[model samples]
Target: MSRGTDPYVAGAMDRRIALAHEWDELVERVRRLGPRFASFLAPPRTQDFLSAVGDGTAVLINVARECHALLVTASGVTAVPLPGLSAAEIADRTERHLTALRRTDLAAQRVHHTQQRARVRKVPATYQAHHAAKIEMAEAQAELDRTLLPQLAWLWDTVAEPVLRALGSPARAGAEAGHRIWWCPTGLLSFLPLHAAGYHDGSGRTVLDRAVSSCVPTLRALARAARAPETEPAETDKLLVVAVQEADGMSPLPQVDEELRLLEDMFGPDRLTVLEGPNATREAVLGQLPQHRWAHFSCHGRQDPLAPSTGGLLLTDGVLGIKELGARAYNGDFAFLSACMTAAGGLSLSDEAITVGAALHYSGFRHVVAALWSIDADTATALTGDVFGSLTRGGRFRPQASAAAVTEAVIRLRNDSPAHPSRWAAFTHIGP
Candidate 1:
């Protein structure tokens, strides 16, 4: 367990050897309680992990602090050099992005409040009533873009580009389709959008162009997802649409009805169930979730940085937190969270991957499409239509092709709004 000539490698091996010894002792104590407990406590074997990821997928584990990114493929793991990356740089970028994001969120809330006021007054929004809020939101959005563009470029220059080149990806452009890469970014890197890292200078030199990206909390999580029971493509039929157009104390998602209509047209009433408005209670949604193979939630989502478990989709009755979803077991194929910040993990718990999307994936939803930040309502609706339309192309719900569908939808969104990175770069696909 401690075989290494280099001093740095030897020290790491030595530490691992000590950990293994400690684990063995712990296992021995747990064995007396139950075999299951002992087995659960056992460390992962190298061969098992290698088999789990398969040949087509590669796992990039960005460890804590300033360190080399570890690329784990079916063959083995290798450290990839990231000369331009540093802990300080990642921390600074994370801070800047989050700061801008908070400002944008506040502005959005103010806009929502103004709309709520006008609705209560039984009057249409006047130019003066809506002008200031809109201006504030626009300013915040511009600042967000200003922070986002540079951070994305930095990530590409420092992390993504170097790793892709090392993986034999073409330096020029045009990466082959269908290749998947699971990014396990820890520490400050977790909050950053690894999937959207690029120059965006019309060079097509981005992670989106290079490969389909996913996020995993840990290798153990990936292993569990890989071991989930597989079903025939045709078996995945039912679609559960949880649409909360207007939740109590939350901004109304005006586009949710249109999104539901589009999905209904695609999936039909026979294979789809829509729980909207007053019907989308937390209990009802949770009860319906197990019966469906695919799920779509079009509602307001909240993320509590201090308490991730408290963060969830704003339903008609209450919040359906991720903790609730993670507690249940499901053999589902896909979940589309067309809500705000479903994939945004807490900054404090950066390495934990505590987000609604992660909860669903770990609970056995193999493929999840979620937002990294608050998304424009119209853009969300349009993207939902486009993504689901692409998924159900031959009159079938294809969950395995989720990443490709997301990529296509995002490209279309980007083409439509070339300057607004916030609208296009918000959504991320996390799965095989």
Candidate 2:
């Protein structure tokens, strides 16, 4: 018998068609219930889902027992199998990353102590081990690089390179300015730096090299950011600079003042609402968010390892935790969080992508620049200048160009210190 005339094949086709029709009927019935009911339902059509992607390609990846990447573009959806990745491998690597990160924190502390001690004319007897601390810091940094570099290379070979190949090269795709790629990583993958995935040994085939990478907690989050109304110029064009130079109980960020100065020069005083020191209270910052089109938080950010939601940008009065950030839906364009670990998620809740940076994006900032780990204060200052300089070029607040701007700034930083991934790899853009 011919394949078309086969009973089993015909039965399967009929069942599929019947199920599709029934699904459509059910969808229509739900729609008829009212706008509230309909709002809960996702659009049934493929094009409806594709529309949320905008000009960029959204790669929603699942790294679980079974690993795969669902690439959504304007054209359609395509599945790219991540055969090299495994659940066990991801789990093991994530643990290693956490260990290395902790070591990094210790190293930073030692380095900071050494610097503080050196500043004094006569070193106190209690802090006489400053030289020893410096040596230990260097050793710790070397140890961190060993794990971090290999992880990047692994991600490149297993995940990024294949996905990039499937999407086609930026040159071939006619995206010399860097093709925007929204990384929607799930599970353990959320903990890894997919944006900085690459072989850093002068191989121009890195994720940063090919695409202007931006992260979204989920596809829905990206759509929400896209659908948010733009803040009007009539309301305010002010770039809110919330520089908390020294939050109580935290190490002082001396470069924050310099960052504010550079921002003042790049964007004049009239265009800014400077809230530094005691003025950048949680209430004040939240109040000012609604009035500004853009924001820059030059302060220390804290990440709670056990309770992710407790993580927030360290302000003057208190820490602005993630849960409190959603008090109002903002219409702001962009936010630059030049602080430590603004983008780092909790180890226990690695799948949730719960962080201060994601909270800002959720709160309605279209584009957010954040750090995946602790960043150097000097590097943060320079990077902030580069980012804002790009955003406010020709005296225009162009928030749409933020992702590309961050990419360029990070690339510049990477080029300057090719051997140090810690300096450049931490900063990532989260948005559409």
Candidate 3:
């Protein structure tokens, strides 16, 4: 299983082999008890069951395949299929079946999880090694997805299909934002162009920034046009801020305190309220909603596909996990998330649901706004200031206005110092 000419390849190959060993153990247990006779069959005896199946050694090792298929299908794994055959063949089939299953759904989850975990934190020495191993892992993952997950999906479809289908059925219009903090893991943020957004890595921040500048106005106008007549857009709500930042000391963006104060003054301090952030949970935030329809924030937010534990928003004294977002119920129509990685989600931007915008939309806010990529704080703060300032001047907060305000603000900031054109151009508005 560890056969490889290259050392790096060999190490990765060794990991797969180790996985096989674990699979082998699972199979051996299957052969001893048969598939239908899973330890869960008798009762809560995984302990005694595991011990009883011991000593099969080679024979047990072979059963891993069929056992995998049966257990995966059995749901809750109460029983294993009892094929009318000798123990050795049973073991072999179980092992082989598992090998096949491992080649499918379980494999895909494993691969994605592995890659996601690897990306959780970057390590310099492990960088090259990781990229190289990723190729191998991707191959293995592909083979497993192509081979195993389909079969498992079929099995699930055959068994629990009805219940699952009926359960996720969404209602008309869309799911209500009923006081619950909606969490779409891996939500899309923005579509800004790279150079326009500025990046130290020389990546596509410009392309992404341009996408933001170009799209924000269009989306904002579309939303306004789509109004249901019950609500009209706000002119003082012109701030189309797209901020991506982590919480500092478990608190929302502090640099924006001055800007937020300015907004309170312009939009009316009574019209705005700062809910939970670094120290608050989603549940705490939904306790109250903006009856006035507009709101702003200077907080921390995170979106990571593989690390939900590390994903959350900053209140004041603590971080609110996205997993717990469903607890908060939002009633406001418009909102903003000045947090980091708010829009990052699955590899495909569209499929990602972790952005604050998606959460707001899912919760009930019709004209939710958001950001896509990471942003520069001072620049973002300055742009946001311009936005509120424009809105207070009665300029419509439509998509174009929002976009123009953000862009022009950045332009003005840069014009103030021709040498620093890159500073204020990092923020963009993601309109709904």
Candidate 4:
């Protein structure tokens, strides 16, 4: 019976059990240390967070009743009130917007299969379903515009503008061109696009108008990322680019090929290890993660509302769940997720920051770029290419400068596609 069993498998199982016991012992020891040591184990203090901002940057923490804006400049930190926006209102609007987006996506799928469905036996049912979906999408679009725009304007007036004023309004000194602000919204506000909040009446008053926007899961996360040691760009610095365009039971992302080709050109084929199509398995990607300084995934992302921690990037073999991700220790600089809804935290786990972006942050990546909602393939490709281009300009990869690089890249996309907030607003930087 011992000879029949695989020795390697048995050895791995033994190691896992030993590790589990060690982890349990460590946890018990920590518990015995009591509440005095708990603060040390917890997130950093407000002063530590203020130091992380490092001039010309602010951090916004949105809670249930109201939002707190911490304007951190070279001098000190100033806490300001973001009035007229509550958690309940944010939750309502988020649900409405997400529902509208889902309807629109279903309509798009129906439209794509219209010609194929026309040839099927149940033509009438297919046609009726498609037509009904189209009508639903139109109504949802109208409703979204009617309800969401006003809320965005209100957010701009109440939250963003106040934060801007507290920071001395970077727009006045032409500082908006270079200044950055990191938004750290809690609860339901995580689903809303605080970066795109603006008065849509052609007033040119928006968050983007004042400063480039980025996001962080927490101020403590930002502080930790800022303290990450900078490494010089070398030939040994490898990038792992995973593209799952043809996964089973999923629509093919034909544009991902072009995206990968573009990335290869920017990062050089010698430095990038491309795991694409059938080879982009969960085990393959996870095994290679520790070897690379940067990783980019162009695939589908599923956010499990009921079990947010179980949600992950959809690879060829299976989902690369956040729980699996948190088990790894990495020293990577960034993880750029060119997938849909990578930053959409479930309502129940809203304050917990249980999303792919946050997972990457916790997994030891200094910076993470992920989407707040589903993004079109073409737009994602363009945005990602521009981001990499900005980061690697003049044949140098500056990981420490990712915040500005990501912000500027998104700003460029917003300028080119001014009418479509969905295109430019979905992708956001989630750390320093």
Tell me, by TM-score, which candidate is best: 1
For model 4, the stretches where C-alpha displacement exceeds 4 angstroms are 1-43, 62-67, 72-74, 108-148, 172-178, 200-202, 234-236
- What do the candidate models score in CA lDDT, each in turn? 0.82, 0.83, 0.40, 0.76
Residues 376-396 of candidate 2: C-alpha lDDT, one tens digit per residue: 889999999888888788877
N/CA/C clash count, model 3: 81
Error of 4 at 404 (Å): 2.4
- How would you encode candidate 4's per-residue C-alpha lDDT over 1-432 as one tens digit per residue? 287889899999899999999987786688679775655444467776767777657566656455677666547777788676676677787778777667666665665566346557466887786677667656655665565577678778768888777766655322236457888887778787887777644455777666767788877788888778787765438889999996655567767898899888988878899999899998999899998889999998878655788788999998988888878988889889999878888878788888998998888988888998767788888888888887888897776677666666766776785656667777788776
Better of 3 and 4 by TM-score: 4
Answer with 2 or 4, whichever has the higher TM-score.
2
- On lDDT, the candidate that comes out on top is 2
- Give TM-scores for every candidate, taking all chains together and pairing residue i with residue i: 0.88, 0.87, 0.42, 0.83
For candidate 3, write residues 1-432 as lDDT tens digits.
345488988889899999999987876677577655554323343343223222210011112223311211112222323232233543343344335433432343444455554677566644655565557555654453343323323323322222222222222111111111111111121221221422312232221212223222222223332342444554333332222223453323456666666665665543445443342434445444433355565665555545533466565445556555434454444555555545444324333344454555445444444554344466556666776676457633333244445545555665564333324433444432
lDDT of 1 by residue, 1-432 (tens): 335478888889889999999988877887778754655666877776687778645556455455677888888888887778888878887888888999999998888888777667755554357668989999999999888888888888888887887787654443236356778887878888888888777787888777777777777787777877768654446999998988887777889989988988998888988898899999999999888889999999999766777889999998999899899988898999999999988867877889999999999888899988999999999999998988889976788788778887887787687667888888888877
All models, RMSD in angstroms: 7.0, 8.1, 22.7, 9.6
How well does candidate 4 match the true structure in TM-score terms? 0.83
- Residue 344 lDDT (model 2): 83
What lDDT score goes with residue 101 in model 1? 94
